[model samples]
Structures are given as C-alpha cells and as structure tokens.
Target: MNRFGTVVIGGGQAGLVMGYHLKRRGEDFVILEGHPRIGDSWRRRYDSLRLFSPPRYASLPGLPIPVDDCPTRDEMGDYLEQYAAHFELPVRAGVRVTRVSRDAEGFRVETDEGEYLADQVIVAGGSHAVPQRPAFASELDPAIRQLHSLEYRNPEQLADGTVLVVGAANSGTDIALEAVKTHRTLLAGRHPGQVPVDIDSGRGRMMLPIVMFVFRHVLTRRTPMGRKALAEREGHGVTLVRNKLADLDAAGVVATSRIESVRDGQPVTAEGDILPDVGTVVWCTGSGPDHSFLDLPVFEGGRVRHERGVATGEPGLMFLGLEFQFAVASGTIQGLDRDARYLLRQLRQNTVRSASRPVTVDRR
Candidate 1:
C-alpha cells in the first residue's frame, strides 16, 4: 500500500489550505477528493448563489481573491482551481474514501481506488454532505413530490401546482422567491435573520465601521430577542413583514403552522388544518455531518472531540472545517484558513516529537 505522512480527506477549502501548509513545511501529504474535479461542490450550487461574505474575505492562504470586491461563485471555483495548480497540491480526485481506521502503524484509509497508510489523517469534509430531511416527510403521500434543497435546481422541476417550501433559511428564502415567479409558493418556518449582501452601500458606507463592532463585539447570536431586534432592524438587511406568512395565505398560498402529520396524500398542520391539494413539498431543513467513513474513537457526544482543531484522546487525528469547531465562523471558507493554519502547526509539532523519540530495539 502507498504510504503518506498525512492524508487530508475532502478537497474543499479546508483540505486545500491544509495541503498548502503541508507543502510549505516540506511534509509529505496527499489530498483525497470524492469529486472528479476541484471545487466541484461550489460549481454545483444554484446558478444564482453567491458568497455570503465579500470576496476580500473569501480568499485562502497565499492566494488573493480574483479582483478585490465581490467575486461570483464561478469566479470562486476558478480561483480554487488556480490555487490547486499554483501549489501543485497532490490531489487524488474521484477517490471516495470508504473507511479510516487505526492500527499499530497509524491510519489506514480505504478508498475506491486503493488503500493508503498515513501517519496522520485530517477529515475536512465540512457539514453539508448529508442533507437533513424531516422524518415525518416520508409518511406523506407518494403522489406529493418531495425534494430537499440539495436536489432542488429550479422551479421547472416542480409540479404544476402549488409549492410549499419549508424552512426560511437562505436556501429556503431563495427557493421561495424563485418559485414565486411561477408556482404559488408558501414559505413556512420562522423568519430568518439576514444581513445585507452589500453592507457598504450609500447609507451603509457611513455606518460600515460601526457595523463590525455591533456584529462582532456587541451583538451575538445568543443575545436576547429585544437586543437582537435592535441589531436585526438596524444591521440586519431585510425586515420580515408583520404577516409574511399571512401574506402568502392571502395570495392563495396556504400558510400553515409547523407540519404535524401527512395522511391520505395531504399535510396536516399543527392546527389540524389539512392541505390536501398541494403538489410539491420542498424540504429545505438543512444538513448534518456525514461521518460514516470515520472509524475512530475521537468522536464524542456525536461530535468529533478536538482541542483547537487537534483531535484529543487520539494522536495524529485531526478535524477541520467543522461547524462551530472553535468559533461560529469555523465552517466558513474564510474561517477554515485559520483552522488549517492551527492544524498545520500541530502537525509540525507531532513530526518533531516523532523524530526526537528514542529508538529501542526488541531483543528476542
């Protein structure tokens, strides 16, 4: 089997950044990617999708954003390809990692292409791999076409009748807005807190400096709703209409409370209101971590236990690009860079320790 100093799983931003750092340190490592090409995940996103943050914050280590202002999704993809080429990162694409286990030697990575033995392993797949659909959704009638946000491309694929979009996050909101142009759309779930796509606009430019202070230093996700309301109104980009759900109801788009049950080809709301005539039900719930391939004792309480990106209780096992791994920004493209750098430092320390170990021979 081929052996490596380190093996990084998933070729996204986190993996690429780790590879760059490993190269700089003169470490022998390889990146394993499930996709056929680099940045295929970003390229497959909806055509209308763009980075939530500005281009200035979207760059990885040693590579600047394409222009300087705001780079589109396609531009981001191209930049990643360029980043990979510039570093000459050793990436084995189209190789799906099936399992990772520990033995006396170290990590044993089994993939579709072949097996690899690595002294260390880095799992950087992030959280979006597994789509989370509601369990009750399966009980719905087979006639009602149900799709997750991951599978949703455009409104054309939906049935010719009314469409119900559950969850009001970015994907849910964008999908609802897109579907409204064609089918009667009903947006369900709590209103989402939003920020302006361009925070440095006409009036926003003047308050730009204060915006950072409020979002970072003062306001937080854990703030009280009243305090959050102040920031939500002033800093939050959009306002939820007093009766946004009610508006959908008035527009012939049924506005129901949380889904309770589905029986006889119908969705029964919490109030026992049954909407039987709905054609499509798009579940934009979200996703969970798909770590089925991870075979280690590092995971604790359903999450990988790591101290500042270094896996605890297990030597030479680390995780990067996990949601809230250290901070709320840990999973973001910008945040992965910091985690990658920290992980690289830990890896270098490990290498030094291994080299300094005293060699002892076994005498039979």
Candidate 2:
C-alpha cells in the first residue's frame, strides 16, 4: 500500500491550502481529488457563476486571483489549477475516496485506485458531497425536466416553458434572473436577507474589509455572537450578495411561497397553489457532506463532532471547509488560510505530546 505522512481527502481550495502549509513545513502529504483535474469542481459549476466577493477576498493564501473584477466560474477554476501548478503541490486527481477508517498504525484511506496508509488524514473535501433534492422530486411529471442546481448549467438546458426555481437563496435567485431572459420564471421560498449595500459598489468595496473582518474574527466560534450565528446558520441561507429581491422583481420573476409538495404532476406551494405550467423545476436546495464513508465515532446529532474543525474523539483526524467551522467565512477561500494554520499547529502539538510520552514495554 502507498504510504505518506499525511493524506488530504480533497484537492479543492481547502485541501490545496492544507497542502500548502504542509509543504511549507516540509511535511510529506498528498491531496486526493475525485475529479481528473485540480479545479474541475469549480469548472463544473453553472456557467453564470461568479465570485460574490471581489478579487482580493477571492484569492488563496499564496496566489492572487488573476482578475481585478469578480471572477467567472471558469476563471476561478483555471486559477485553482494555476495555484496547484505554481506551488507544485502533491495532488492525485481521479482518485475517488471510498472509505476512511482507523488502522493500528494510523489511518487507512481506501480509494478506487488503491489503498493508502497515512499517519494523519485531513478531510478538506467540502460539505457539498451529494446534490440535495426533496423526495417528492421523483414524483414530479416525467415530461417536466427536473434538475438540482448542481446539475444546472444554463438556460439552454431548460425546456421551452416557464421555469420554477425552488429555494429563493442566492443560487435560486441567480438562476431565476437568468431564466427570466428566455422563459417565464417563478422563484419560490423566502430569502434569508440581502446585503445592505451592493457588494460591487464603491462604498461596498471600502466596507468589504470591515465585513470580512467581522466574519473572520468577530463572528468566530470563540465569540458568543458567533456561536449564536453558527447555531442559526443551518436553517438560514447566506444573505444575498449580488442579487437581491428587487432584482428578482425587476427581472419579472414571480416570487411564491415555499414548495411543500407535488399534486397532479405539478409543484404545490405551502399556500396550496399548484404550478401546472412549470416545464422545468430547478431545485436550489443546499447539500451536505456525505460522511457515510467515514468509519469513525466523530459525529453528534447528525453533525461531525469537532472543536473548530479538529475531531474531538479521533486523533490524527481533522476536517476543513465545513460551514461555520470556526467562523461564518470558514467555507470560503480566504478562511482556509487561518483554519489550515490552526489545524497544523494542533497537529504539531499532538505529535510532540505523542513523542514525549514514556514508552511502556509489554512484559510477556
């Protein structure tokens, strides 16, 4: 079996950042990516996707984004590939991790290619493992095209009719605005809120640093307000940034109640209004990490039991890129820098503690 000092179970921003820190410390590690390319995850996103943050906030630790303006999905993807190449980070693409379990020596990483033995493992694979959709989605009319936001590419993918976009969050609003250009669009569900100012405006740019500071430092797991925000974050979608409720209205997209069920081969909302003319239903509901492959007792109440991304019960196991892991920005690119540093420090401390312990010999 292949062996390394550490194995990172992703090649995205989080994993790459972890690899960067590990490399800085001259640690042996490998980043395993399921996709064939380093940044295919971003490349695979919907075409209209762009970074909500400006170039400064969108960059990784070592490399600045090549764009001065908000970057497109492809630009971000290419930049990630560039970052990996520039750093010469050890990455193994096209290696799908099937399971990760504890071994006598350390940890066993099972993948489609082969097995790997590592003294430590870092899961920076992100939270969106599976595309989430309601069970009733299967009950929709077979003739009506249905897709999760993850599968949505462009309006060209939709059929020739009105489109019903479920989940009135950022993705849903963005898709609705796009769909309105070609087809009649209906946006459902209530948005959490909107940013007080336009993020791209001059004043917003000036305020970006302050907002980011609050998100990164003030609103952290250590603060009471941050803990409250984390508790509420699970139910609330991120506040709208680029697109607002006014934009959706101005774009002629009809806003409706949340989708509760399906009736007569159509989508029915909470108010019992059935949308019969919705030729396409785009589910923009959020997704969660699929930790089913993890064979560890590190979960509590359906969530990973961790203290700021460090697995509490499991040694040599760490998680990165989890929403609200330490702060509201924990899942963002800029957040990885600090998270990686903290985790690595913890790892070093653990190693030192392990090494300093007195060796007990077994008497037979």
Candidate 3:
C-alpha cells in the first residue's frame, strides 16, 4: 500500500485527472487528499459562491458538470463526489502528505497516516493551497474581527459593524458585494480588470462562449498576448468573472485604492485617507501554492519552474493545476485534462526512456 508507481498529492480536479490518466496508462498510482472528502476545496468556500462558467465550462475531462446554469458550491462538491465515484479513482482521502523528499527509491512522501514510496510524484495540489493576506493586517486593533477569504464561509462569521474587504480579486469583490447586504462594506485595492460585458446580461451571455474560446484557445502560453498576460497577472488577479465593478458600484460598496496601512484604530488607504468604524477586515487578497512540504530547490521567483508541468530538477517529479500553469484556464477544471494528458505523456516517455537505459552496476 505504501509503494506506488506514482503518488499524486491532492484529490481535487487536478488529482482526479492525474488519477484518471495514470489508471488509463495502467500505472499503479494513488491520490492522497488532505480533506476527508473530495471537493472540500469548493465546499468550504464562502456560502453563496457560484461558478462564473456554466456547466459546460466548469466540467472535468469526460465528466460534465450537470448544472444548467452556473453551478453552486454544494453542487460542485456533489459533482466531485460523483466524478470520483464514477471514475473509481484510487483516492485515499484524509491522507495529508506532510513532507515530500527525493530518495534513491524515487520519492518518499510522508503522510499523517503513513509513508508512501513512489517512482514518480505529481504535486497535484489544487491552485489555492495558501491563503494570502497583508502583513499590516496583524497591526489592526485587537478588537477588530479579521478573516482570510478562505476562512470566510458566510457573513454570519462577521461582527455587527462595517466590513472592510481588501483586495479586488474575484473573491474580494464577491465577498464585498455579499458583505454589503448586511453590513457597510468598503473595498480597497487595485480592482482587477473587469470583463467588457456583463456575463449574466443578454450581451454578456452571448459573449461567454467568446470568452471561453479566448481563454481556452487564444490565451495560452504559446501566444504572445497570453504570455504577456501570464506575466502581468502574476501580481494581479484575473479579470472579474460572474461579478463586475458595475455590480459593486450598484451594490453601494465603496471602492478605493490599495490599503496603505492602519492608523488611529482604523483602516487607511493608499490615498492618505482613513477608514473609520470598520468592525471586520476580510483579506481576500489572493493565495499561492504551498510547496513548503516540497524538499526540492525547484522554486524560481516564488513559483515552481517547470516546462508545462514537468519538473526540471527532479526527473520523476511533476506538477499540475498551478494558476496559469500553461494557459489562462490551466488552473481550472476545464484545463486539468489538457495539462494532465501532457504531463502524462512526458512522464510515460521519461519512464520508458529510463527503463531502456543500460543499467550501470557500481561493482566497486
């Protein structure tokens, strides 16, 4: 049970696809998921969360998300459950890989339950592993309630006071828009660019397919615009999806520049102004991959350096589901199959090439 030809760490979309491909290739692989159940990543999101893409775009390889409209959080969790069951993926849930290190055996992955040895390791952890927040957040008043977007399930988690949602990404806007329903909310940050059209509106509905076509086809690592976008968005968020600046504007959520810091027991903006009477601070800034468990020097400028998911330094190691790992949709469920298949091809070639190599015996 501890030995495998490949060990995929994570049971989300990326892990599932990796499992599917590995199984198809007849490789002995196991997917280790930290959560007790599949799709916990989506299930744990703030309530009222909905996918921007319709079922057609939100689906995984060979499995369509059965939602007629955009899927809800619970429905997504359900779909993941059904997908795992349908595929019969060898996913061992609740087995968190605490540490990963290379060994002569290929790789040693230590989990909470036990240890697993694999000839190849695929770091298939979903894109959002670590929830990011600002350093100045801790400087806020001890009386203020602060929560990272990951910890935000619903507005019920907040106190009865003005809510300051920092960051203008998709989650930030969503949370701000939601927070305004019950509490006075202020959104401060470089608002991520919005789609030119409202997706829910008639004009926007017509444009959805075009957007997908662009992201899936035009916006790829191979294209110049895509490469430029990928480089620029490393510090920025994707263009607003499902919701837009117009929604926030109509919702009465005050939008402002980046939060400079806290002053006089209040939130301050980069514009030399102070936000007073803020009771809660929701840090919807962003997140990054948690490769802390990885004991390799593959990191370059805060990202794992790989040529389309294939690990560079480690021969038997690979990566998947990284945000814009190759294309605009590379981190999404739709892109999982494409990236997984490419990595599988590379992995199989490596395996075959390794096996074919002449065995050198150290006869000393």
lDDT by residue (99-135, candidate 1, tens digit) is: 9998866789999988887778998874687877767
Q: How does candidate 1 fare on TM-score?
A: 0.83
Over the stretch 47-117, how does candidate 3's per-residue lDDT look in tens digits? 98998877777888778888888899999988988899998888888888888987665688998998887
| Residue 49 lDDT (model 1) | 64
| Candidate ranking (lDDT, best to worst) | 2, 3, 1
In candidate 3, which residue pairs clash?
none
- By TM-score, the better pick of 1 and 3 is 3
TM-score of each: 0.83, 0.95, 0.93
Best by TM-score: 2
Per model, how many backbone clashes are there? 0, 0, 0
Candidate 3 lDDT: 0.83
Least accurate 10 contiguous residues by lDDT in model 1: 234-243
The runs of at least 3 residues in candidate 2 whose Cα sits more than 4 Å from the true structure, single-residue gaps closed, are 351-364
True lDDT of residue 44, candidate 1: 73
lDDT of 2 by residue, 34-95 (tens): 99998999988899999887889889987899998989999998998999999999898999
